[model samples]
Every structure is written in C-alpha cells, then in structure tokens.
Target: MGRRSVLPALCLLLLLAWGQPGAAQAAPADPPRAPSTVYAASPALAPGAITVHPYGQLQQSDSLDDYDTSPAASIADPLEPWNRFWFHFNDIFYLYVAKPAYNAWVFVTPHQLRSGLKNFFSNALFPMRFVNNILQFRFLEAGVEFGRFFINTTTTLGFADVAKGKKTIVPVDPTGEDFGQTLGRWGIGHGFYVVWPFIGPSSVRDSVGRVGDCFTDPFFYVYPWELATSSELALRFNALGDVLPLYEDLNSAAVDPYIAMREAYINFRNSQVKH
Candidate 1:
C-alpha cells in the first residue's frame, strides 16, 4: 500500500488503542463516565475552544466558523485555528457521515454479531496491553494479560472472556495501557492539546505515542493483507456505534463542547499517568 492507503490503517489501530470506557459494549453508547470534579464546570470562553452548539446556524455563523480564517485568541492551544477547523470537520463528519453509517450497521447487524466483533477486536490487540505493561515494569500485570490472551484465543477463539469470571483463577486487568501512558509514566510532558480530524482529542505527546502503539496492533500482521484491512475497518465502524452517542451527550451538556472535550481528555490522560 502507498503512504495514503496506510494512513487509515494506522488511524484505525490508534483508535482501537485509544480505547474509551464502554468501547466494548453494544451501542446506544453508554453515558460518559461522570466528568471529574475539575471538568464539571464550563471552561472560559476563548479562541481555540472546541465548541459545538446544537444550533446549526452557530456552527456556520461567525462564532464557530471564524476559526477557519482567524487565529486562536489564546496560547492554550496556539494551534486552535487549525484545530478548530478540524474540530468542525470531525463534528460534521460524525453527524452526517459516521453516525448514519453506525446506525445502518446497527440496523442490519445482530447484537450478538456486533458483540463478537468487539470481543475479537479486543482480543486481536493483546500486544498493546502486553507491551505497555512490560514498559511500566508491571511484570505481573503483563503476565496476566499474556495468559488472558491465550485462554481467550485458544478455547473460545476470543468470543468469550473467561478471565473476567468472578471465580476465575487468573484475573484479567481490563485497564489496558498504551504508549501515551507509557511516555507519561517516564516523565514525558503533554506538550499541547490537539483536536485530530475524525480521531478527536489528543496532545502532542499522546499523538506521537499513538503512532508507536499502532506498530503493536496485531491486525497489521497475523492475517493476510486484505483480511487485515477489512478486520480493522469492521472493528472501528463497530466502535463508532458506541462512541458517537457519547459525543452527542457531551456536546449537548457542555457550554462549549470543544473546551469540555479538551479539559476532560487532559484530566483523563493525567489521571491515567498518575495511576
């Protein structure tokens, strides 16, 4: 594949590795985990904020659309001009494109099949969890991740997760780690906030770290190229079903969706590193 063709696969891997809460669940995506105390209030009105008013006119009017032609008023996200532009791009894409596609996928696909896809995708990315655990020197956690993969892969072909059982001898840790957290654990700073097109919230450190995590994704190997391509697509489209609704809820509740997502994401990433 050419460079352009490879981009989608990498984005897909990062999306999977980016694993939000309730990502594995069937859709009508769960309510967002309650925002942390700090994020419970609205951010100050500022340029480079990622706002999505429910009103269509505001999205098209001077309030939001000016980001394309104007510089962000603050250094909080000096990249805000471009970031706001992409934020709008992603918002429109999700509403008109991704959300509709997700609805159609849900309409035709049985819940059981979707659930299997979820399990299989999670199983396929075992290396992300395994390697990150090792990076953090959590050898025992790494071992549990290792055993969980073999048991799930061999006995049930990843359709069932026996490791999650209440009485199971080997307990699995569902709090999967990623390259971003690994970097943070090693004292890397979150350089600045970024709103990636289609991919959503991230920072400079996490963005670079995301690319690294993609190399650990099993979908890039194991299966034939064509099979690998289709598998990754299926996994992400399925994930979209569980992600878009949460986006809708967050946007509706926030005074400015952009700042809400930015603050929440930063707080969440910091919490992940501290843990």
Candidate 2:
C-alpha cells in the first residue's frame, strides 16, 4: 500500500481504540506526514477563533465523497519517544488480550444481544453527553438528549434504541458530542498528540476530557472498584466487536505503524474538534 491508504486504516483503528469515553473519531484520509507538523487543532483561523475543521474537512460536502487529504495542522510533539513506547505497548495489548476476548465475546453472543448491550451502554452514558452538550451551550441538544434518554429508558429499558426512529418528534441521535468536543468548542488547543497506553491515541485536551467524562459515566455510580472496572472493561469488550475490521485493516496496511497511526490519529482528532 502507498502511504495514503495506510494512515486512513490506522486512523480509524486509533479512533476506536480502548473504547474510552470521549475518544476521538475520524472519517478517513489524511495529509502527508511531516515531522514538524503531523498533529493538531490549528492556531485558529484568527486569534481565539477556529473555522470548521481548519486543518481539513473530515469528509467532503457531497457526503458521498470521502476524505480530503489536505495538509494537516501542526502541534509540537515534545514526547514522541515516550508516546511511541506506549504505542507499541498498546499494539501488543491489542494483539494478545483484546483480540482474543473479542473473539470469545463474538463466538458466544448473538449479534442482536451484542447490539443490545451496545445500545444499553450508550443509553447508560446519556449523562455524559447531556452534560457536555450543556457545557457547550448546546441546550437544544441537551434537551434532545434528555428526551431520547427518557423515551429509550421507558420503552426499551435502555436495551434497544427505540427512540431512534422517532425523528419526526425526536431528533436523530448525535455522536461525538462530549467533554473533549466541548473543550475544543470553548477554544482549548489540542496541545499535542500522545499515545496513552491502552487508551491509544489522544491529546492533552482530550485526555482531560476523558477524566471529566468518567464523572458522568454510569460506571461511576456502581460500587466497588472491581465492579466498576469490570463493567467498564466489558463495555470496551463489547465495543471491540465493531472495530475489529478496522484494527485488521490498520495492521495489514501500516508500513511504519507507529508514525502512520500517530499521524492518522492527529488528523482524525483534528477533524473531529470542529463539530
């Protein structure tokens, strides 16, 4: 594969890595790698203001078209060596632990059951989204979130996304609305890219957002560290199913997996902070 194809694959895998709350996301495609400028949220279109995805668009306006590999914005990487070490650690962890668990999980659970758990977990995390929306001053979206949460909890007990089809009355569920995006909206810079062990790719701002997200996650309400950690890990395990193909794609295509994944993550997260 040429350099182009590799990063998109890596980007997607990193985007879904760890299944952590407020994790970054991407469409696909990224600019050529440059040591001085591989990762960031840009210096702003003007002081204290950023245009929509200032580095580049995530996907094209046509919506059918995919990826615009324009040159990505820049951020200083003072911790490249440390980040790379953790990157490899995460790679091995995925290979030996996560993939096997995903296989076992898939082999035992039916698809409907898996999806149900996924929906339940998402529904359970409604407070995270709701609070972040409120923080970002997206009161409308916060209200919508509350409405959807009520509908889903009442109708399906949170097992199924029964509120999903009611777009006429209920808005479509939104994704990528969380503490990280809220921070970005409030003008916090990405700081720099870092590979956070099992959490995979993240930046300083996003890392902080993850901590904030933990406060609102349902896992926080559960007692006992064992129960909380296990529930959180199971959420990751159930989530692992959706991103397996992405991981394999990254594995197969990445020539210099670390740099490719790093740049992919940078570009991907940059793409997300806009919205």
Candidate 3:
C-alpha cells in the first residue's frame, strides 16, 4: 500500500502512545511541566509591551517558511550532535547568505521590485491552484490565496503543484490554511517546538503541515533535471528576497532569540489551528 494510506495509522499510533497506560504513568500527574520562566531574565517590560512583543514575535516567526526546531527545543532540552550540526549550518546560512542578501535588498529599497516579481510568479501559477481549489472546494485555498495577496505573495508560488498535474496526482496545497487548522480542529495539540535544519521554528502540528506542504508544492512536480538546473535556483532567489523582512523582524524582536522564536511559533501554530 502507499505511504499515504499508512499515515492515518501512524497518527493514530501517536495518539494512542500519548494515552497509553505506561506512557500516562510515565507522564507527570499534575500536567506537563511548563518550561521554566528563567529564560525571561531579560529586563521586565510593561504588560502592553510583553503582549505586543509576543504578538509581533509570533507574526515574525510565522513568516519564516523554513524549519529551525533545534535551537528552540534546545533551550528546554539538551541538544543532540545532529541537532547542533543543523543549528550551526542554519546559523551559517543566516549569517552569510540570508542576512547579507536581506540587507542588500532592503537597503536597495527593492521591496516593490521583489513584490512584483513574486506576484508575476504567483499569477503564472494561479490557474493551477484555481482549478485545484474549485475541484476540491477547499476553502483553505482561498485563505492561502488571501494570505498570498496580503501577507506575502511568495506563499502562492509555494502552493503550486505543477508536478502533481504532470503525474496526474491530485495534490493538495500543504501550506493551505486547511491543513494546519484541520489538525487543530481534530484535537491534535501543538507539541513542543523544534528547529528543523533548513526550515525554521515549528511545532509538531506545523511540522506535519510542512511535510504535507512539500508533497503538494509545485517544485516536487517538476522532474529532477528541470528542478536542479534552473527552476530551483529561481524559486530560491525569489523566496529569499521575499522573506527578508520576516527574518529581520524575528532577529530584531526575539528576547531569548530562539526561545522567543519557539514560543511565537507555537503560538502561531495554535492560532492557525484555532482558525
């Protein structure tokens, strides 16, 4: 059977594991121990500021479409070498590539240019998603498209699944509003934060969303040769340019840097689930 058929079973296993007698016994009786507030050591702020920062932080953190789960989780739990390795690489990418490129684009005041290019790409793929959205009647596609129009247009490009059309597989938009919200509606609580290597801050629910999104992304629809040669490069360039502001905001507002990021990520995922 296809792996897709097994996923429901896998999720059921996770739910069962969480409620199993032995597992419940192992868990603390009172509740899952909340992470310590010691990390809040940065000078106390007004309640309003705290609220705003967390909100801004969540907004900023959600903008990073990439994964970075280790740094956030490491704040509470010890890090494994693999996690560290990925963290180091993430740092390198941020410091050398992402940061510099962002500065260049912002300093050059190319927001409109970048935005237009993103729109062009998105409009090009509009037909595909329009067809998919109509066929499936997934209202989340409308939300995803709305987010693309207002919050960030790059997401629209990410939603395209050209390869699925090529393969005659009906691909769902993983990054669509329905995916994350669906998980929340189904009673899947957001788990602890994790910093995936190339991806940034995400919780268990969002992580699952990421996997599903990848499967449905148009990039996966392309053949390996076409993807590696030019399509990937174009997409990467557009993505970096588009997401520059989000990275800047996250770096600027983070209190514990990564912890603030983790909390914000969890909060955003939870919000998405609620909506």
**What RMSD does each model have against the real structure?**
10.2, 10.7, 12.1
Q: What stretches of model 2 exceed 4 Å from their correct place?
A: 1-33, 36-72, 168-173
Residue range 198-248, candidate 2, lDDT tens digits: 778787877777766766666665655456666766776787765655555
- Sliding window of 10 residues with minimal summed lDDT for model 3: 15-24
Number of the top TM-score candidate: 1
Specify the poorest-scoring 10-residue window by lDDT in model 2. 43-52
What would the per-residue lDDT of candidate 3 be over residues 109-177, giving only the tens digit for each residue?
A: 666666556455554444334433433345555445444444334444434332322321232333333
Off by over 4 Å in 1: 1-9, 12-16, 19-75, 167-175, 222-227
Greater-lDDT candidate between 1 and 2: 1
Clashing pairs in 1: 50-258
Q: Rank by lDDT, highest first.
A: 1, 2, 3
Evaluated with lDDT, which candidate comes out highest? 1
- Whole-model lDDT for model 2 versus the true structure? 0.59
**lDDT measured at residue 40 in model 1 versus the true structure, 0 to 100:** 42
**How do the residues 95-170 of candidate 1 rate in per-residue lDDT, one tens digit apiece?**
9988888899889999888887888777877899889878777676678778888988998898766666544333
- Model 3 residue-pair collision total: 14
What's the true lDDT of residue 88 in model 1? 84
